[model samples]
Target chain A: MMTLLFILFATSMWLGWHGKRKPAIFVFLVTIALCAFWFKHHATSELHIDL
Target chain B: MTPTFARKLNVIFLIMICIPLIGAYTIQFGRGEFPCPLCLLQRLAMLGIACGAMMNVRYGIRASHYGMCMISAVLGACISTRQILLHIVPEPGNTGYGSAVMGMHLYTWALLIFIATILILGVVFLFDSQFESKEATSKTRSVPALGAVAFWLAFGITVANVCTTFLECGFKQCPENPTSYLML
Candidate 1:
């Protein structure tokens, strides 16, 4: 799941580099979607005990 | 007020972000220490900041661009702060997860960077000199050669992270306290 986030960031950077303004913004939005998912996942999940 | 100065600042911060990311890669690959999920999230935030700064460098300065940087910094800070609080045990001997850098844990360093980013953003906003003016509207802005290099460097780092993360997690939840590469 985290791998997907980095991929989105890379894509956004590449698009921004090429002056694809709107597409870069869209890519960032996708990255934000992943962020929201992760935040929810972490907040709701219980920490597993090692013992 | 000059666009050139704004562009230069963006490039400078972009390079600044690259430095820490390089160190992170070195620690991960060179020292063979894998980053946990939260650490990876911090990396994502840093890369996101670089992306915004790179956009400012590539294009002319825009308020929305700085907004992007601000958003990323806040998110990074939240993640790092959460990690820090999790390890704040009453017990005296708890060293927390992962190794420390220069006597401070890496997540602590990440929190510092995020705070620094907010401070920098605040300072940059106070000037407002970078905003495009009516008279300066006639001027044309071109992306600097160095900015292009920084962009590619950031992109490469992000891609490398993607590869490393995929190897570690493989479409599964990354270990909370990752010690070794799952694929390894």
Candidate 2:
């Protein structure tokens, strides 16, 4: 899963370098979505802080 | 600052960003301390932050690119903050996870770096000169060689990460507290 995320980053860079701005940005957005997912997944431990 | 100089600064920024990743790598291998899952996420966010600057270098200085970078930094800050809170009150003699530099763990330093990146990018946005037409800006931004190197360095590290991460975790989830490379 972690490796796949890094691959997406590399693909985004490759697409951007080749001048495919739209596709690069598109992949970047996907990257962002996945990052949010991973963050949620890993931060599952309950925080004990009070409001 | 001129658009060209801004691009140069973006290049320089990319180089600066690589420092922490390099340090992380050194510690991972040198100290034989594997990165936990949260550590990998922090690294991922760092790469995401780099992607924004990378877009500026490749396409031109667009606010959206910096926006992307800041977005990543925000995510990174949250992740680091999570780790810090988890270890906020470690058991007696626990200190914290991994090694400490300057009396703080890497995640604490990561939090600082993320905040700094956001603030620095925000300040850079004030120039408002780099947002000119994309074509005109790209045409004027002729010093692509250095910018290209910086972009590739970050990109190359990402690629290297893919390899190392696979070695460390394979297709399974990375260990919560990794002690050794899983595949090795």
Give me the candidate number with maximum TM-score.
2
Q: How does residue A48 of candidate 1 score in lDDT?
A: 37
> How does candidate 2 score on lDDT?
0.85
Candidate 2, number of clashes: 0
DockQ scores for all predicted structures: 0.45, 0.66
Worst ten-residue run, lDDT, model 1 chain B?
A: B132-141
The regions of model 2 sitting more than 4 angstroms off are B135-143
Q: What are the clashing pairs of model 1?
A: none
- Docking class for candidate 1: acceptable
**Predicted candidate 1 versus true structure: per-residue lDDT over A1-51, tens digit per residue:** 898898889889878777687788789877966885786577544433443
Best by DockQ: 2
- Worst lDDT 10-window in candidate 2 chain B: B134-143
TM-score per model for chain B alone?
0.91, 0.93
Tens digits of lDDT, candidate 2, A2-49 = 889999999988887777777877898898789889889888888656
